[model samples]
Target: MTTTVVTHQPGIIAQSQVVVQVTERDWSTSLFGCFEDIGSCLCGWLCYPCFACQVATNAGEHCITPCCVPGAMIALRLKVRARLNIQGSLCNDCLVDTFCGPCSACQMHREINNSSNGHLQ
Candidate 1:
């Protein structure tokens, strides 16, 4: 006697075939690797809010949105992760934003830079 397995969801296997293959990639820069870009580090150190706003603007978000809304950085991080197919969770985003806010911002800046070919516009 043989057992047969069936999936209840239709086209589950077919959908997998239709899915586009995307290569997983890590963040272009490390969170604490701010020294790699002295300009960004100085901007983040001298005026954190300005740096955050610049990052937000570069990401197509309103300049003041990050300042007015709480957890905006986390949301931006998640967006960047999804766009790049990077593996990360909301909890991780939150933790990174909470513990190393400046570093996280710098990393996001670097990611945007790498993705956009050094154009933050």
Candidate 2:
């Protein structure tokens, strides 16, 4: 599936904001990696288990797009997307929930907290 989003790149000076037409591929690649990478910081906001879902969808010859699932898949996808859009740029309810996994934010926070605590020892 393809989605389009408009992004503005901050310019070096005022009135220099460059509006770029971002395509899904740009985000999708990172999003896909978020699902595959065990250490992604945006995993929670995009918890689609995209890898597994792609395999299942491929086997059935279904549409190779960003489709929604239920249960674990949905839950995971939401978590991943949440992590990516943690700045309140996106909403959790707007996404389809189907999977239940450690959200990227939760994981990142845990890691950060652990690292900091370790230094206090």
Candidate 3:
């Protein structure tokens, strides 16, 4: 298993060590789990650009990137999957984006929100 050691300097001269285990796991929410979060679902349904921007921002990415670049959501999904060790592929990302872009964005947003306390990594 791969593990990461994170160090924190609490004081000017004192430091502490924290170990974080990196485990592979599936996504917290399915692609069709948009309705699970009413807020996310409504936001995604009513205003897709705003929802996409929120997802991108939550993932520590530029909010405007998804707007300016095509397929940016797919790239964000891939990055999040890689960071969290989620099993998926570029083809899957493409399909999700193509078929249910809004729902996919909402799902990714919820997953990221649930996984890291609203932080990306």
Best by lDDT: 3
* Per-residue error (Å), model 1, residue 7: 22
**Superposed model 3: Cα runs more than 4 Å off:** 1-23
User: Per-residue alpha-carbon lDDT of model 3 for 1-121, expressed as tens digits?
Assistant: 9997868655657559999977778888888886689999999989999989999999999989899998899999898898878888899989999899998898888888888889787
Give the whole-model CA lDDT for all candidates, comma-separated: 0.85, 0.36, 0.88
TM-score, each model?
Answer: 0.79, 0.20, 0.78
Clashes in predicted model 2: 29
List the candidates ranked by TM-score, beginning with the highest.
1, 3, 2
Instruction: Give the per-residue lDDT digits (tens) of candidate 2, residues 77-105.
Output: 34433434322223342341213233422
Given candidate 3, what's the lDDT at residue 60?
A: 93
Minimum summed lDDT over a 10-residue window in model 1 is located at 10-19
Which RMSD values do the candidates have, in order?
Answer: 6.7, 18.5, 10.8
Stretches off by above 4 angstroms in model 1 are: 1-17, 118-121
Q: What TM-score does model 3 achieve against the real structure?
A: 0.78
By lDDT, is 2 or 3 better? Answer: 3
TM-score of 1: 0.79
